[model samples]
Target: MPSDPNRKIDIECDVAVIGAGTAGLAAERSARRAGARTLLIDDRFAGTTCASVGCMPSKLLIAAANVAHGIHGAPQFGIHADKVTIDGKAVMNRVRTLRDEFVSSARESIEDLPDGAKLKGKAKFINRDRLEVAGKIVHARSVVIATGSSPSIPETFDGMNNILTNETVFELDDLPSSLAVIGAGPLGLELAQAFSRLGVEVIVFDEGDAVAALKDEDIARTLRGLLEREFAIHLGVKVRASQTGQTIELAWSGESDGKKRFTHVLVAAGRLPNLQDLNLASAGLDLDEHGTPAFDRRTMQCGQSSIFLAGDCDADVPVLHEASAEGAIAGNNAARHPDIRPSKRSTPLAITFTDPPSASIGAPASEDTIVGVADFSDQGRAKVEAKNAGMIRIYADETGKLTGAAMAAPQGEHLAHLVAWAIEDGLTAMQLLDKPFYHPTYEEGLRSALRQICSQSQVSFGPDRDEGSVPGV
Candidate 1:
């Protein structure tokens, strides 16, 4: 088809997705699967930070840091390392290369969309079922608001020029000699560990009880111990103010003492949605007091049925996986329109990529008689690789059903996926115990944890048990 230059190029689609992020991409894919014409748009590059600057680049840095740690500590594994040094600049170069590769791949994916799928520049809502993109008005039967978020910067901080957000961290050519990570959430802790291992003087501060505050206490305690033992951690501390005119001036108050101190501060507190630029009021939508789009949970529909919310822009958990899941649900339903059916979302599987990495699935915490542990020290492969530094914990009910689980180890991220599958599939503790797991693999840790749980259960309800022996029975 030849270009229609004089036609204003205004297009129509069954569904129009506003962000080309993980959720937006998943939504587009689902829309195509449902045979809907989908048009995806973004203000910057189509893909969000996870692909361009956030998760992808951060994990690359983590992997490089881990390699440096392993090489520097090789003597303990009976390997001779007469010379062990990490070139910080070189490591950062590799991180940049990897991030560029991801950006390229994301661009290719967007360009390769099928005929029914189209990509465009900045899109703003003109009215319900209508959006203005690149000076042209496009109409859709339904719209999906997947516009993602950005780092939330404190207004009191004066050194905005020196301070950097997750989106800008990957652009650094050299690492800072000393870094003060302001928030102790997953992002803060992850970066602190990575930078500390890479020879940066890292001081992490958290006003919350601990990093990953929403996680279980035991996990938080274990992670706190690991970070404190390896890096500097200051909990229950608040940054009163910061000035970046020359040396970063940080005014902070610690919990125990009301005394204040000054230091260089790096703020990683949290993120706010990118709602202002969208001109949502033009489409008859208003943000809640918290500035998030107030929408129906189940349907994700905004004030108007044709406008659906997805990703961090909405009030759901700001996880890439959750965003993608919501995007697909919202996109598919919008594309199908009148014939739409209810979409179901299973429990979210997530992880914190620290030195040991922490993975979790299902409810926040599990209270059951059946608890299991699999230390990395016992894993034959981890032992062989000399990376035995963490453990896997599992919780189950009285019926031997898997409830919730978490793992801290080099394979924490990978192992968490399997546990997530087991929990989501409703596999009982005994069933997982019987399932075959390959030897000399991180997955063996799963078998080890379940085996321990079985032994504990057996010991509790031993062979000598009689019908009248236990009060519960």
Candidate 2:
């Protein structure tokens, strides 16, 4: 409803949800399911980061790039063809076409809601139990903050209109002839490789030693080496950029102290929570040391009993699945009368979609953990596929429980999911080894790593014998 400047209208709801992204949508559904009269509010665009720009669109581009890469590498598999060329404009058109479909689907979900359930305006906290949205006072019993986040552009590139982020990079009609990608995080690496494969001269710069926030040092080193072979990578360096007449010039120091020119620059540094205009002080909440409202990560509850924070707004976990889970928990709690309890969290899993994908799951390797290694260079399926260039490392505790795993290999996503499930189920290395492993498959590499972990474990598997036989028999 449009705001009336003269007077404010009073609306009542059992639960109020802010933002229209994945978390907010989930929160609204969960609140309604819990028998609460829910109101969802979003001032900005309707589509989510994933559907619009973050995950789906980026993957669409990567899929096109992968096809181009496959055709070029077909000769190694004895499937040679001439004139393998990529049309940058056509590739982007396909990405945008698919991306729009996903966005439309997401928008349809919220658009189908009942009348008065969704509001199109920014909401501010008038008081602990009241919100000012479009000059209407929302008297909600409970509130959920799922406002999400936005890309964090470096202060150094403040006025550079040509700099592209994930939000704008996908909108490009034609790929740049040369690109400089700042920040070697997941988004940066994914897009960098994708552009390079599509015939763009790409260079990636990171202030950190590792890319994609990889926890395992060995796996990070291996992945870095592989990426360096494809694109010019400068790690552990300070990068400076300047405009030089329709061209972006980048200079860095560390392994290389040289300046290079690029047609465009993409900044994939990080993200900032969308919380500044929420007027949180009126709700009796203050930003914590991290400049986000203090909340219990397990419960998603803010200091105030009636308010809860979830998703990127809480800054606990940024992945889509985590956001949905948090929203469900927050919504359920918000709909309840009293006595809010904490919810169980899922096992951590991260993936990077490079040619040989990188994946990590569960707790990071520590001193209390035993490490097992398997090189894909010797794995059967990887050799057969001619993509044998990475390794898998699994970690187990002293008692043989699967602690964590990291892999930079073919089908790492599937392998990571398997490991994450095992870890979440509290399975040990021996139990994982006992599972059936198909012959000559990429999963066999996972089996090999588990076997190594079992060997290094303190727990002993007594008398290697068939399970069909009894002890007395």
Q: Which candidate is the best by lDDT?
A: 2
**TM-scores for all candidates?**
0.86, 0.95
Model 2 residue 237 CA deviation (Å) reads 1.4
**Among all windows of ten consecutive residues in candidate 2, which has the lowest summed lDDT?**
464-473
- For candidate 2, write residues 98-182 as lDDT tens digits: 9999999999989889898988899988776788887678888999999999889888787865799999999999888999999
Stretches of candidate 1 above 4 Å error? 1-10, 114-119, 256-265, 285-287, 295-299, 366-370, 375-385, 437-473
Q: What are the C-alpha RMSDs, in order, of all predicted structures?
A: 5.8, 4.0
The lDDT of each candidate is 0.73, 0.86
Give the runs in model 2 whose Cα sits over 4 Å from its true position.
Answer: 1-9, 465-473
Please provide, for model 1 over 1-473, each residue's C-alpha lDDT reduced to its tens digit, 9 standing for 90 to 100.
32233444378888888888887887788887889888887766545668786789999999988887887888887888767677888888999888888888888878788774675678876766677787777888888888887788777674445576687777778887777787988888888888888888777777777675436666677777767877867788776654545446555577633323323346688888877767676677767887666776666666556778888878577888788778878877787776656666776777888877887777655454477777666567777776666767787776667878866676788878877888888987777755665655777667656756666564333464221211110
